[model samples]
Target: MTKKVLYRIATLLGLIAILFVSTASTWYIYQGDTPEELL
Candidate 1:
């Protein structure tokens, strides 16, 4: 594959990873009805 193709794939994968992580983080922060341990 070309370097440009590889870089695009890498960037897409990174973005997907970031989206996945942020979604999970938001769910974790907002999913509960009680006080968190850190609060």
Candidate 2:
């Protein structure tokens, strides 16, 4: 694959990972856990 395509894929994966982490953190917060614990 071209470098440009690979870079785009990497960026997309990074964004998805951030989204997942934020969602998980929010869920944890609602479960009575601090977000710092997740970090």
Candidate 3:
């Protein structure tokens, strides 16, 4: 049971990390295209 819980937590963390990276990259690219608007 404990192992299952840990696995779930790890999976959640991995998904969150992936989403964070994707969002960061997308924002970075968008800012590159529209530097004036972001500022």
Candidate 4:
């Protein structure tokens, strides 16, 4: 693939990861747990 395509894919993956982490943290907070407990 071209460099542009690869970069786009990487950017998309990063955004998805950020969204997933945020959602997980929110869920943890809702459950009365600190995110640190996930470690």
Candidate 5:
């Protein structure tokens, strides 16, 4: 594959990973009983 294609794939993977992490963290935070528990 070309360098440009590889770079795009890497960037897309990074974005997907970040999105997954944020979504998981948000789910966990909301699952807590109180807002204070988030701290």
Candidate 6:
């Protein structure tokens, strides 16, 4: 029971981390592109 709970918690944390990384990467790319488009 403890193992299953730990696994679920780990999976949730990993997904959260992945989402955070994806958001940051997308934001960074968007910021880089907007300057060129404006010019």
lDDT of 3: 0.91
Give candidate 1's whole-model lDDT.
0.93
lDDT of 5 at 10: 97
For candidate 1, lDDT tens digit of each residue in 1-39? Answer: 699999999999999999999999999989877567766
| lDDT-better candidate, 1 vs 3 | 1
Q: What would you estimate as the lDDT of candidate 6?
A: 0.91
The 10-residue segment of model 5 with minimum total lDDT is 30-39
Clashing pairs in 3: none
Local accuracy of candidate 2 as per-residue lDDT tens digits, 1-39 = 699999999999999999999999889778874578667
True-vs-predicted CA distance for residue 3, candidate 1, Å? 0.1
Candidate 3 Cα outliers beyond 4 Å, as residue runs: 33-39
lDDT, residue 33, model 1: 75
Q: How far is candidate 5 from the true structure (C-alpha RMSD, Å)?
A: 3.0
Q: What does candidate 6's lDDT look like per residue over 1-39, in tens digits?
A: 999999999999999999999999998888754666667
Q: Estimate each model's TM-score.
A: 0.79, 0.74, 0.79, 0.75, 0.77, 0.79
The TM-score of candidate 4 is 0.75
Compute the lDDT of residue 26 as modeled in candidate 6. 90
Model 5 collision count = 0
Q: How many clashes would you count in candidate 3?
A: 0
Q: Which stretches of candidate 5 lie over 4 Å from their true place?
A: 34-39
Clashes of each: 0, 0, 0, 0, 0, 0
Shift in Å, residue 22, candidate 3: 0.1
Sliding window of 10 residues with minimal summed lDDT for model 1: 30-39
Name the TM-score of candidate 1: 0.79
